[model samples]
Target: MAARNSAPEKRPGLISQIKTLLKFTKDVYPWLPWVLIGIIVAGIALGVGLGFLIPPVALWSIILWGVTGLMLGFLAAMITMSRLATKAMYAKIDGMPGATGYVITSGLGRGWHADETPVGVNPKTQDAVYRAIGRAGILIVGEGAEGRLSRLINEEKMRAKRVAPQVPVHVMYVGNGEGQVSIKALGKTVKALPKSISKATQAAVIKRMDSMTQGMASLPIPKGIDPTKVRAPRPR
Candidate 1:
C-alpha cells in the first residue's frame, strides 16, 4: 500500500520534470525538424545494434526499445513544438508595442520561468511595454519609439515594484540604439550568467516575484493561432 501510494505521489514530479526539459529542448531547436527524424533513426539503429550484439537479449531489448523510443519521441516533439511555440509567440506580439523586447526576453535565460506580460497599454495607439518576468527580477521592456521607452520603462517598473518589492528589477531598452541591449545578443546576454546559481535560488526568485506580481497573468493567446496545430512528432 505504501509503495502504491508513493508511486502516485512520485509520478507528477517525474512528469512535470519531463515536460520542463521538453520545453527547453523545443526552445533550443525551433527550426530543426530533420534533426528529430535523425534522432529517431539513430535511436532505433542503436537499439537494434545493442539487441543483436548481446546473445538472446530479448528482455533487455524490450527495455532498451521502450526507453530509446520514448526519448526519441520527446526529441521529435521538442523539435516540432519549439518552432510552433516560437512562431505562435511571435505572431501574437509582432508589431505590438515592445514586441522585440518580448521576443528577446522570451528566448533568454534557460532554467528560469519567464513570462511576458502586458501591463500598460496606450489607449490611443495601442502601444504597450511588456513586463519580462525572470529569475533576475522583472524587466520592463519597452517596444515603441526609442524616445518614449524611458518613460514607459519607468512606469512599468513602478507598477511591478508595487507588487514585487523584494525582487530586484531591471529596465532595459531594446534596439540597436546606443546603450540599449540589442536583439541579436539577447540569448548570449542571458546565458552568460554564472551557472553557479542553484535551481532553488532561481525558484525562490520566481516565487518572490510571483508573490509581488500576484493576480498578473500572461497576455491572451492571439486569435487565429491554434496551439494544437503544432507539427506531429515522429513516430517512435
Candidate 2:
C-alpha cells in the first residue's frame, strides 16, 4: 500500500532524470547521431545472430530479438552518456590547483581519506600541494603555473616529513609540462603507488596527516562542481 502511494512521486523524478541526462549528452557532444548509429549497428548484429540461431522462428521470436536489441542499445547509450559526462566535468575544473585533490577523494572510490583544504599554497604564484591518505599512503599533488608545482612539491615534502617522517609520501604534479601527469590520469597515478599501509593503519595515518593541513592559504578554488549535476545528479 505504501509503495503504491509513492509511485506518482517516483515516476516523474525518474522521467526528469532521463530527460536531463539526454539533454546533457546532447549539449556537450552534439554528435548523438554517431552514438545512435553505433548502437543501432550493434543491435542489428545481435538480432541477426539471434535470427540465425533460433529454431523455426515465428513472428514472436522476431519481435523478441528486436526487443532484446533495443535493450542492448539502451544500455550502450547509458555508457556513452557516462563517458561524455566525465569528460565535460574534467574540462571545467582541470587546471585549478585543487583539481587534483578534488577528483581524488570524490571521483576515486572509497577507502581514501583525502583533505578538502590544500596542504601548501603560494598566495602569489597559486602553486599548491593538496594532500590525501589512503591504503596507498600519503599523496601530495602539486598544480599551478609552469615550474611552480615542482618547488611547491619540494616544500610540501619537507613539511610532511616533519609531521610523519616514517609514512611514505608520494608526490604528483598535474599539468601538461615536461614531467607532469594530465588531470584525467590523476586517479590512476595515485592507485599505482605502492600499498604502504593497511586499512586500519590508513585511518591512523590520516589522523596524523591533519597536522599537514595547518596554515594552508585560501585560494579561489572551486569545490563540488560535478558536470553531471544538470539537476538530478544528487538523489534524496
Cα lDDT, all candidates: 0.55, 0.69
Tens-place lDDT per residue, model 2, 1-236, is 45555444544475576666666566667786578678877886787578668966877777788778878886776776767766755665667546766677676678677755566677776666777877777788877765666677787688778876878888777887788888878887777777877887787777666654544445444343433342224211
- Report the poorest 10 consecutive residues by lDDT, candidate 2: 227-236
Residues 84-122, candidate 1, lDDT per residue (tens digit)? 555544444344344544454446745546554445555
TM-score of each: 0.43, 0.78
Candidate 1 structure lDDT: 0.55
Error of 2 at 226 (Å): 6.9
Best candidate according to lDDT: 2
